[model samples]
Target chain A: MKIVLIGSGNIATHMGKAFMHTGHQIVQVYSRTLANAQALAKLLNSTGTDSLEAVVDHADLYLLAVSDAVIPEVAAQLPQELEGLVVHASGATHIDVLDKFRHAGVIYPIQTFSKSVDLELTETPFAVEAREPADTSTLITFMSAISNRVFEGSSEQRMAMHLAAVFANNFSNALFQVAYDLLAQHDLPFDLIRPIILQTAEKVQNNEPRAVQTGPASRNDQNTINKHLQFISSNPDWQSIYQKISDLIVKRKENNSEN
Target chain B: MKIVLIGSGNIATHMGKAFMHTGHQIVQVYSRTLANAQALAKLLNSTGTDSLEAVVDHADLYLLAVSDAVIPEVAAQLPQELEGLVVHASGATHIDVLDKFRHAGVIYPIQTFSKSVDLELTETPFAVEAREPADTSTLITFMSAISNRVFEGSSEQRMAMHLAAVFANNFSNALFQVAYDLLAQHDLPFDLIRPIILQTAEKVQNNEPRAVQTGPASRNDQNTINKHLQFISSNPDWQSIYQKISDLIVKRKENNSEN
Candidate 1:
């Protein structure tokens, strides 16, 4: 399968490598910055271009791995008569953003990608959606070649999944940052909490997160909560976060008990 | 070393098993309830009792593995002239809570423990603190037998570490619970986000968490943030959390740029 990668960002670099590893031909790579396109193309042994007109129109797939805000602008740049299945690798953007193409779809790899990190794509789940049944099957085949986990879902489900990912990955990491900063303020090394962070993530794999939740908030220990709130009083932002999240946990526990 | 475990809760159970595994002699287990103590004692091949007076006085160490609120009460119950080094396995409670003892210390393992989950304690870091130099060395040797990672700090440092753990372990798990609940509401399987969670945690081991943070919040993508806020409008608690955390992330990012 000949593929044209539409961006040279972190997601694009990872998806491009995964596609190439699966024996697919990356015929062209495009980026607004010529250097990045050329760098990725050099590694993939593909043509690199900064202009959408230079994209190979006859490739089997055109993967738009750009940011959510740029999906429309990038899609508008493609030749209106291009002959390929056009797909965007965004969880938040709706597939309708690709409606300019005759054949449009989405192949959202539901994992955070970092250019320096070598991720194992085989187990990473891909959420696929296409305007037509045949296109959906093509996406399934394309994605299955790179990953073992693939599921069909609508834009609503994908967006919901993206929101959940934010909570699980981004928001959780933000909370970790909070912990890191707190420890740093006290001259405590971040290593002090690394084991606990790893263990907390490991526990959720087999147990329900709610069942495994442990802390003052879960126990409704107001005294400790008040002490923590007082400790972070200097930082109003953290104070609000601590209070809000604690309240949410306590409320959820109460609701569960009432049920 | 002869040891007496003075609680039958989750931490006590895990600590008892770890001590027994290291070939230490768990001479007695004491709890407010005889049955609870006996249940754990039976597994460690030791005596169990409800009365504090029945606790073995000549043990090499007395481990107070009770709740933070009950630490003082339990410490008061112990015979004032007891001959063993006394330690409390608590993060929030200070070593001073056991001031009644001639020799007091702390053996706070910095991980969330559950009796159902078999944790590998050898890699889990233990934070040790003691009033005397010899007792600190004794505590270090005992902790080193069960874990390769051990550090010494003051009671103030332990409380701070405990607060950090709440953020790293408890608060992060709460964020996960939010994601789990969100996924459940959408009729999506929790498995969809499992890989992402594991990868997110793994990324932090090698990178600064602040550098690795990604999401609508970190990106300051207000468009997606507003969309998510609208999606969760029915749940005000989630809405407030979404707003507050996003605000915090954006504020932190802006602060970073200024610096």
Candidate 2:
């Protein structure tokens, strides 16, 4: 199918290159900024257009890989009587926003992308949703071309996944910052905590995180917890975080024991 | 140098094997539980003893690899007139607990160990601290035999590293539990979020965690943040975590910008 890329951002650049690498035809690239569109278009060896109105109507898929807020506005600007599946690449946006189009769906990839870092699609999951079964199949086919880990999920499930990712990815990354800050306070290099951080993440790949819960709280070692808290006595923010997470771990462990 | 493992626990088991593999003679394995002592002793071809009275006085090193709370009690029970550098394998415990011995030090390996897992010492940092410079040299030499990643640190620095590990290893691990739970609610398997989790950990390996911060909060994209908060409105605990971490990221970014 001939694909028209919409948006020349990180996701767009990544997907465009990936699609081109897989021998798919990207007919045109669209971005509000012509230079951005042309840059990506040149890479794909396709035409570039600043106007959404200039997006080729003959393309089989027009991926509105724009930011979440601009999805609806971008969809609204598309040429009428389109003969293709119009999909937005957003985890949070619902499919209803593309109601103006006859065939609409979503292709939400669940990984943070940096164009500089090569993305291995075999591990990156693409949670796809479509209004029509046929379109879902189309997405699965196209996405599977790049990645084997494509699944058809509902809009609610996709958005729920977006929320879940915040917990899994964003929040966990912040906890890393907390660790870095703690080490920095003592003039300790981040290298001291590097291996353990990798090991912790690797552990969860094959094991359930809850089952592998560890640390002073998990061990019910209040003595060490007190020592840590007192060590960071000047930082109330760190103390609160430590106390709350510790209490939660202990409380949860007790609950599990009772059951 | 001959070594006596003071406990047949996780840390002791792992370090014992690593040391033995590196051709260090494990003279004895001591555990309060006799069976536990014999189990580890069998692997190392060393003596296993339940009575601290039976702990050999001829060993070059007596490793107090026991629990933190019982360190002093266990130290008091060790045979007097011992002829080796006495060391405790604890991250949180101060070296003072082992001061009863003429030669006291710490060999705190900065990695969580499980007997079931093969510990790669090249990545596992052993932070050594001794009251005397000669003892610290002895420790660095011994530890460097198995792992070249040995460094001399003060008691305060070692303890701070312990607290930092809690944030890096433990708290971040709990966040993975949060992700698993979120996915479980929708009957989604944990596999979907596995790649992102690994990537997040890998990103911080070379870069500062604060610098590599990604997601809605990192972008300060209030639109998605509001959507996410509303989505998890039913779960107060999840909401609180989301809001607090998001606010923290936004505030930290502003501070960084000002600086």
Candidate 3:
């Protein structure tokens, strides 16, 4: 498959490498910065350009791995005569955002990408949504070449999944930040808590999170809760966050019991 | 080291097995229930009894692996004539609670214990806070036989670590539960977000969570935040939680910019 890669960020870097490895031809790499585009293009052994006008639509697929806010603007700037399939690698944006082009779709990689890590694309699930049936198959076959799991979802379902990721991944990571902050404030080594964190994560691999919830909050040990409240009294905002989450845990337990 | 593990509960079950595997002789097992004590004793090839008075202090170490609330009452019942170190494997209880004994200390296993999983005690950290240097060394060697990491920490420090564990592990798991609940309310499969949850946990392993935070909350995208709030508004409690956490993240980002 002939593909044109857009954006030169973390996701773009990994996606470009994977596509190249799968014997796909990367026609050109486009980025706002010349150096960024050149860097990926050199890796792919392809042409590179900074101008949106230089984007050639001669390839079978054009992947926009740019940020959510910039996708529509970039699409609008593309030449109307460009002939190819277009896809955006965004979780939150709708498919209609690319409606200006004859063929539009989404090819979202449902994994956290870092440049240093070795990613097994087969483990990463791809959520593909297209404006047309033919476009869907093109994206599906392209993604399936790199990943073992490919599912077709509507724009609304993808939006909900994206929102849900915020709670499951983003919010959970924020809570970890709070924990790190609380520990550092007390001159505690964050490494000491690593085992517990890993084990907690491993628990969910087999069972439900609600089944594995523990601590003073889940135990309803008011004495310990009061002591923790005293400890975090100085940071009122964090203290409030702590209290709300604890209360929510207790309430969930109650709901589970009634059920 | 010769040891007698008291209370054949979750911690004792794992600790007793680990001690036996490390070639330490468990002289006796004591529990409130004779069957529970005997069950652990049989595993360790030792005698078992129900009464705390029946506890014969023949070993060099006595590990009281029991719940926090029962520690004082159990310690008070132990015979004063007993020799060797006496330690309770608790995260929150103070070591001085066993001050009546000549040798007293703590051995807190930082990981959550369940009966189904065979716990690898070699990686488990034992937080030791003893009344004397000799008792500390005795515990260090005994626990070190089974665990690689052992540190001297006061009851207050252990309590703080325990609280932090709640935030990092227990409370974090509860947040996952909240996500599950929200999805279930909308008749969505909890499986759809599993990949996101796994990635969220993996993100913190390499980066400080404060730096890796993402989502509508992290982006300070009011439109999406307001939409999520409206979606959960039927449940006022969840809506308030969503608001508080979102506001906290936004505030943290602001503080970061100012710095």
- For residues B1-259, could you state the per-residue lDDT of candidate 2 as single tens digits? 8999999988899889888888889999999999999999999989799999998889899888888889989999887688798999888999988877889999998887766566688768889999999999999998998887899988999988999888888887877887888888888998999998898889888788886677788878899999988887887767776887888888889999999
TM-score of the second chain of model 3 compared to its true counterpart: 0.91
The order of the candidates by TM-score, greatest first, is 1, 2, 3
In candidate 3, position B242 carries an lDDT of: 77
TM-score per prediction, in order, is 0.98, 0.95, 0.90
Q: What share of the true interface contacts does each candidate keep?
A: 0.76, 0.75, 0.53
Error of 2 at B159 (Å): 1.9
lDDT of 2 by residue, A1-259 (tens): 7999999988998899888889889999998999988988999999899987777888899899888878878888888679899998888899999998889989999997766666777668999988889999989998998888999888888878888787777888888888888888889898988899888888888888877777889888999999999999997777877887787678778988999
What's the true lDDT of residue A78 in model 1?
A: 90
Lowest summed lDDT across 10 adjacent residues in model 3 chain A is found at A110-119
**Worst window of 10 by summed lDDT in candidate 1 chain A:** A223-232
Q: Give the TM-score of candidate 3.
A: 0.90
Model 1 Cα lDDT, one tens digit per residue, B128-180: 99999999999998899889999898877777888888988888888888888
Candidate numbers sorted by lDDT from highest down:
1, 2, 3
lDDT score for residue A168 of model 1: 87
Clashing pairs in 2: none
lDDT of 3 at B165: 75
